[model samples]
Target chain A: MKSLLKKELSFYLNNPLGYIVIILFAVFANFMFVKDIFVVGSASMRPFFDILPWLLMIFIPALTMRMISEEKRTNTMEVLLSLPVSETQIVVSKFIAVWILTLIGFVLTLGLPISMYVLTGQVGGRIYLPEVFVGYLGELLLAASFIAISLFYSSLTKNQILAFLASVITIFFLIIFSTDFVAGVLPPVLQSVLNYLSPIVQLSNFVKGVIDIRSIFYFLSFTALFLFLTVVDLERRN
Target chain B: MITVKNVTKQFGKTQAVNDVSFTAQKGEIIGFLGPNGAGKTTTMRLILGLIRPTQGEVLVNRLDPLAHRMETLQHIGYLPENNPLYGEMKVREYLSFVAEIKGVSNEEDVSTVIGQVDISEKAQAKIEELSRGYRQRVGLAAALLGNPHILILDEPTSGLDPIEQEKIKNLIKKTAKNKIIIFSTHILSEVEDIATRLVIVSRGTVVYDGDKPKRKGGVEKLFKKLVV
Candidate 1:
């Protein structure tokens, strides 16, 4: 498992795509932070959290789009499956590699809050460090779940484009089902059920500094479910 | 030694391998010859535990492949059809990764296999930059890295030049002296040169399984007689 993780990490580091994802994600997130947090003069990072899920919806897919798909396309999955490693270990190792990469992107965005704190301290307002940290945690969990989903979809096909599209559609639905749009359309009982199913809704609780156990379980369960599916998919493809 | 007992695999309605049973002893080189889509690759995949058999069981070294999995795979090295590799990785890095996964802790053996397969010169080159023949050599080197007791190579010499082909053939012949080697090929003459036994499958069933012909009759003649 360690070897597999090391190989995946090395592959990502050597490829230009990994660097491109980091640079592009940093630029886009910072741009949004400046436009919404600085230009609009908001104390709460609601806008920042608002845009995070969308950014991750696109970015995580790009990161995981070729995880297993390209292996199949190149026929390297056969080589991998034939090795002295179980399917579960292979799936988990690749997931951890992509999750760490996503976490790195989140860590880089910490500069945003630091910049805001400095700017605000120069003036007269409070920094609200705890709220922003909580928000960052929420965003990280959401990104991890989406990455797992993307990795699972990537295993289903040899085409990266198809994986990307499938992930986007799935994440979009997860986001939409959590929004007021679905609540407004559904009856009282159905709305309650749909709201519970919304990953974005679960994330909103974290951004509000609540740290709900239900939300945490939802994110962890979401990730586990997709990872399981990825393992099963790889086994079938083999 | 590898033993396959009444193994059958089906992808929905299309049966890829049907009730295939064979035993390959250690130190024997067997050839799997068949037309396209005739279950050759499917049988190899089943043996490697890449896919599950729909019926019956496949045992490698006295343990069912599906039950033991990694343990059974540790003693086998396989090169799938088309020489699949990580195109983004350098030749040496990819081989090293395979070696690590295959539990080859001996650094010298890794280098020796790379040199033996003639890929040591291109070790630093990325797979995307290498030609078809070079990629095939890298794939072969990876399969040989573990010094596995069983070698399952699918079309191992498909895209090589004459010189490289001869070198690979000779390597296989030398290596098979103490290991079980099963490779699928369409080239009849190549099989004649390397295989000790032949198993021909037609439409998901083994149509021919016997000793290598002592006479000059080609695999095509046998294939026509069985498949046609």
Candidate 2:
């Protein structure tokens, strides 16, 4: 497992994709900070959180789209599978690599809140550190769940583009149904069911600094379920 | 040593390998020959535990491959059909990475195999930048990294030029003195050159398994008579 992790990290660092993801996230987060906090003078980062899921909806797939799909396409999956590693170990290594990359992005966003703190301190006000910290935690969990889903989808196809598109559509629908759009269109019973399935609803509660156990469990279970499915899919292909 | 007992693999309604059974002793170089889609690769995948057979068992070094996958695989090395590699990785880097995963402590093995395959000059080159023959050489070096007891290669010389093909054939023949080597190919000349024993499968069943022919007609005549 350690060897697999080392190989993945080296591969990502040697290639340009990892740096591109970091740069893109940094730019987008800075733009959101300028537009939402500076121009609008909003105390809440609702705009940032609103765009966070969308950015991740596209970015996480870009990170994970090639994890297993490229291996199958190039026929290198057989070489790896034939090595002295179990199917679960391979899945865990790839998932952990992408999850660590997402975590790095979360850590980099700390600059936003720190910059906000500096601006507010000059005016004799305090920055709401707790709320922002909770929001970061929430985003981390959300990104992990999306990475799991993308990894599983990647294992299903040899085409990375198809995997990326499928992940975006699936995550987009999950985000849309979490909003008031579901209640506006569906009956109450169906609306409640769809809302339960929406990650956006769960993520919103985190953005508000409420660490609900149910929401945490939702993200954890979502990650575990997809990882289990990825293991099964790879085993079948082998 | 390896043993296979009544191993069968089915894909939905089709049986890709049907109740196939064979045993290979230590230090034997066997050739697996078949047409396209004849289950040669499938059977090799089964032996390496990359895929589980639908029924029966595969034992490598006296342990079931499914149950003891890691331990069993530690004794074997495999190169799949087409020799897929990470294109962005340099040849030396890729070889070192595979060696780490296979638990080769001695870094000298990497350089030794690179020299043996005559690709030491191209060690720093990326896989994508190499020609087809050089890429295949890199793949062979990877399989030879850990000094495994068993080597399984699927079409090791499919796309090489004629001179490169002869070099690979000679390499495999020279390396098979102490290890059990099994390779699958459609080319009759390859089997004739290096195979001590031959196993031919057609439509998922073994049609022939015996010693290499001593006469002059070559495997093409024998395969035509058996597969026809």
Candidate 3:
């Protein structure tokens, strides 16, 4: 499992296109924060957390677009399955790789929040430590969910483009299901269920700087469900 | 040694392999011969524990392939059909990764197989940069890592030139002296040249299983009769 993880990390770190995409994600992250700073006329993490779900819908899929799909396309999935590695090991290694890449990109945006506190300390701008911590917690949970979702889609098809598009569209629907317009289209009871299913709604709880056990379960269950689906789907092809 | 006892696999309603039973002892090159889609690869996948046998059992080295998957996997080396490789990785780099995945991390195994496959010169080249023949060699080199007890090569030379075909056949001959090799090939001449035994399957059933031909073109005659 460690070897697989190392191999995956090497693929991302060494590939020119892979590293370039990661760098580009960071650049856009900082850019998002800077633009938000101007628009809001204040230094807070609300905008960053707000745009994260959208960023993740695109970025996580790009990170995992080839996870299982490429192996199937190249027929290397057979070779991998024939090895001594377990299915859990392979899936976990890939999930960890995507998580590592996402976290690195998320970390790059740290400079903005820190510099906001530092540069604007003269103007009474304060960085709420607890909110920043919870926001980061939300980021990790959302990333976990998105990465798992992408891996599941990747396992379903050999085409990376199809995997990317499918996961993006699924996540887009999940995000919008929490909105007022979409909620209005459903019955009151169904709307509540949709809001509970929405990652954005769960993320909103974290950005508000509160730790809700229900939200934690929601993120974890969402991640676990998809990861399990990925393993089972790949197993069927075997 | 591998024992496949009345193994049958079905994908939905279609029986990919039906009641297939065979034993591959150590040092035997058992060639699985059939036309395309004739369950050769399916049986190989069964032996490798890639899929479950719906109606029977497959044992690798006395252990069930599924129950003792990782252990059995350690004992067998598989070169899947099409020989998929990480196109971005250098030959040596890819071999090293295989070595790690197979629990053979030492540089010695990597270098030894690189030399054995005659890819020492191309070790630094990316897999996509190599010729078809060389890419096949790299695939063979990876299979050779850790000196596994059993080898499963699924159509190892299907798309190669005559020269490349000869090279793989010779490589198999050299390596099969002590290790068990179960390879699938439609080319009867290649089978006659390399395999010690023949197991011919047609439409998911093994019609013939016996020793290497005692006479010239004998396996061909037998294969033709059984395949159709």
Candidate 4:
């Protein structure tokens, strides 16, 4: 298991993809911060928090698209499966590789919240540190679920683009369910039920400093469900 | 050190390998010969536990491949049909990575396998930068880790220059002195010259299995009569 993790980490670190994703993430995240704080002259990170899901909806798929599909495309999956390792170990290692990469990207956004806190302190204005920290946690949880979803799709196809597209469509729907467009189209009872399932709605509570257990549980269970499916898919293949 | 018994693999309605049975002991080079789509690779895959046989069993060093997958795989090293490699990684990096996963990452062991396969010069070069022959050598190097007792190679000499072919053939001969070597090849003359025994499969069945022919071109006559 350690060997597999080391090999996966080296693959991203040695190639340009890892660096490219991090750079793009830092730039886009800071751009959101500037638009929210500087352009609007607001003390809150509401715009930055709002834009995060869209960024991850596009980038998490790109991060995880190649995990298994590349191996299958090159016939290296045969070598991987033939090893003494179990199917579950392979799935977990891949998940950790992408999850950790996403964590690094999330950590790099510290500058936004830290700057907001410091600049607000300097001007004697109000910026809630607790809410900002909780919001980052929410984003990480959402990213974890997205990684798991992407990992499952990557296992189902040999084409990375197909995996990426599948992840985007699935996650896009999850985000869509939280929007007023979906609520407006449905009855109040159905809207409430659907909104409870939407990660965007669940995460909104965290961004507001609510720290609800249901949202955390939803993200965790969603991640576990997909990873379990990934293991089952590979187990069935061999 | 390897035994295959009554193994039949069915892909949908078509049989890929049909009721094949063979045994190979230590210090013998068994040539698995068959034309394309003749079930040679499929049989090798079964023996390596890459896929299961529909009916029957494969045992490597007396361990059932399906039931005791890890313990059985520990004694055997396999080079799959296509010789797939990580082209982005340097030769040494790729070799060491395989060695680590195989639990033979001791510095001496990795260097020895690399030296044995004659890939030391290309150690720093990326696999994509190497020629087809060198890439094959790197694959062989990966399989040779841990000094496994059984080596199952599917088409070990395919798509190589004569010089490269000769080197691999010679290496196989040298290594067969102490290991159970089962290699599949479609090239008749290549197998005829080196194999201690021949197992020829045609249309998913083994048509012949016995000692190598003592006379020149005798196996060719036998193959032509039996297979094509």
Candidate 5:
């Protein structure tokens, strides 16, 4: 299991994809955060927190789209499955590799928050550290769920582009479920049910410094469910 | 010993393998010969438990391969058809990774297998940069790690020059003692040179399984007569 994880990490670190994703993430995320800081005039990270899901929707899929698809495309999945490894191990290793890479991208963007802190200190504005920490945790959980979903899609097909598109479409629905457009179209009871399932609603609680255990459980369980599905799909190899 | 009994693999509407049965004991090299889409690779996959048999069973050392996958895999080393590899990784790095998976992470084992396959010179090069012959060598070297009891190679010499083919044949010959080696190939001369036993499949069914014919004209005449 360790060897498989190491090999997955090597593919990420050695190839240009890992660095490219991180670099684009840092640049685009910071750019949007900075743009919102001057307009909001309170050094708040609300805009950053709001834009994070969209950023991850694109980037996480890009990172995970090739995780299983490339192995199938090149027929290396045969070699991988023939090893003394189980389908669960392969799925977990791929999940951990993408999670770690997302964590690295998070670390690089720490400078954005630190800069906000220093600017707020000099200008006599208020910024809550607790809320920022909670918001970052929320984003990490969201990214984990996205990674799992993207990996499931990747395992379904041998084409990376198809995987990427499927993941993006799925995440788009998850994000929009809590919006007014979706709410207006649904009956009130169904709206409440969809709201509970919407990632946006769950993520909003974290961004507000609520620290609700239900949201955390929701994210974790969603991640686990998709990973389990990926393992089952891979085991159904023809 | 490797035993494939009445194995059939059906993919959707297509039957890739049909009621095939064969057994090879230790110290025997079985050359699996068949034309394109003849189910050679599918049979090998069944033995490796990459795909389950539709209506039959595959056993490695008297245990069901699907039920005892890790144990059977530990005893078997397979070089799949087309020799798929991580093209971006260095040969040595790739082998080391495979060694770690095989529970033989010792550097000495990796180095020894590299030497055995005569690919020591290209060990530092990326797999994509090596020629077809060297890539096949790296695959063979990976299979040789952990000193597996059964070696299943699918078309190990499908596309190589005469000299490279001879080298691979020699490597198989040198490693054939006390191990069940089953390799598939289109080259009749390869079976004539190294195979002690022969199994030929046509259209997903085994048509012949017996001792390699020692008479003049060798496997060529027999294959022509039996395959079609």
Candidate 6:
């Protein structure tokens, strides 16, 4: 499993296009977040966390769209399956690779939050660093779920473009299902269910500096569910 | 020994393999011959545990490949059809990755196979940069890693020139002394040249499984009689 993970990581890290996309995501996301900091006149992390899911909807799918699809296209999946590695290990290794790439982008945006926190303190403005850290944790969990979701799509199709588009559409719906306009039109019971299912809703608590265990559980379970589905899809191919 | 007993594999409505059975013992080179889409690759996949048999079992050294995947896979090295490889990777890098994946981290095995296949000069080149013959050799070198007991090569010499074909055939002959080598090919002459046993399939069912034909007609006549 370690070797498989190493190979997956090497593919993601060594590919020039993959590396550039990751850097572009970090720069663009941080650029958006910094723009918000100046326009909103506060060091609050709400804008960063709020816009993160949108960024991830595009970025994570880009990272994952080629995970299994390329293997299938190149017919290397046959060679990989012939190895001693299990379907679950292959899926998990790919999930971790995309997850790590997403985290790298997240880490690059750290300078903005830290500099803001320190600058705010020096200027006698109030900014809680722990709140930003908790928000980071939530965003990471959300990114993990998105990575798993996109990987599941990647496993379903050989066309990377189709995988990316499918992931983007699915994630778009998940994000919008939490909105007031969408939920307000639904019955209260269904609205509550959609809210529970919505990653944006789960992330709201974290962005508010609340370390909600239920939200954490929701994200972890969501990630695990999609990863399990991906493994099932791969095994079905075998 | 590899035993595929009454195996049938179906993909949705299409039956790719139908009640086919064959066994290959060590030190035997089984030339698996059939027309296109005649379940040759499917059967090879079944033995490698890449896919499961729908109706029966495949045993590698008396253990079910699906149940003992790691054990069976460790005993078998497969060069799949088309000889699929990570084309962007250098030959050495690709073999090293395969070695690591197969739990054989010994760099000596990599160098040895590179020399064995006479791809030492192209070892530093990316796999995509090599010709089909060199790519096939790299694939063979990967299969030879860890000294697997069984070698399943599907059309390993396809698309190569006559000289490259002879070289590959010779390598297969040289490597078949102790390993159970089952290679699928369309070339009738190749079977007559190197195979000790022959297994022919037509439309997903085995038509012949016995010694290579040796009477007035060679494999060409026998293959036409059974498969054509």
| Model 3 residue pairs with clashes | none
Ten residues in sequence with the least summed lDDT for candidate 1 chain B? B214-223
Q: Candidates' lDDT values, in order?
A: 0.87, 0.87, 0.89, 0.87, 0.92, 0.90
Kindly report which residue stretches of model 2 are placed more than 4 angstroms away from their true locations once superposed: none
Where is model 4 more than 4 Å wrong at Cα? A38-41, A187-193
Place model 1 in a CAPRI quality band: medium
- 3 or 4, greater by DockQ: 3
lDDT of 5 by residue, B110-167 (tens): 9999999999999999999999999999999999999999999999998989999999
Relative to the true interface, what fraction of contacts does candidate 3 keep?
A: 0.76
- Point to the candidate with the largest TM-score: 5
**What lDDT does candidate 4 reach at residue A146?**
94
- Candidate 1: what lDDT? 0.87
Per-residue lDDT over A112-222 for candidate 1, one digit per residue giving the tens place of the 0 to 100 score: 878878888888795788888888888888888998899999999999999999999999988888677777888989888877888888988777877888888999999
Cα lDDT tens digits, model 2, A1-95, are 88788777777888898989877887887677666576777656556776799889988999999999999988888889887878898999998
**Over the stretch B166-215, how does candidate 6's per-residue lDDT look in tens digits?**
99999999888789999999988988998999999999999999999785
Give the range of the ten consecutive residues with the poorest summed lDDT in model 6 chain A.
Answer: A34-43
Residue B191 displacement in candidate 6 (angstroms): 0.8
How high is the lDDT of residue A200 in model 1? 82
Better lDDT candidate (1, 2) = 2
i-RMS, each model, one decimal: 1.8, 1.8, 1.6, 1.7, 1.1, 1.7
Q: Write the per-residue lDDT of candidate 3 for residues A110-227, one digit (tens) a residue.
A: 8877887787786886878798889989989999999999999999999999999999999999999899999779999999988888999998989989988899999999999999
Q: Residue A199 in candidate 2 has what lDDT?
A: 93
Question: How much RMSD separates candidate 2 from the native structure?
Answer: 2.1
In every candidate, what fraction of the native interface contacts is reproduced? 0.91, 0.74, 0.76, 0.52, 0.78, 0.78
Worst 10 residues of 3 chain B by lDDT: B219-228
lDDT of 2 by residue, B1-228 (tens): 888889899988989999898889877889999899899999998898777889988999999887788998988888888888989889998898889888885779989999989998999999999999999999999998888999999999998889999999999998897899999987788899899999999989888888888876568888998886
Q: What CAPRI class is candidate 3?
A: medium
- Point out the higher-scoring one by TM-score: 2 or 4: 4
Q: Which pairs in model 2 have colliding backbones?
A: none
TM-score of each: 0.94, 0.93, 0.95, 0.94, 0.97, 0.97
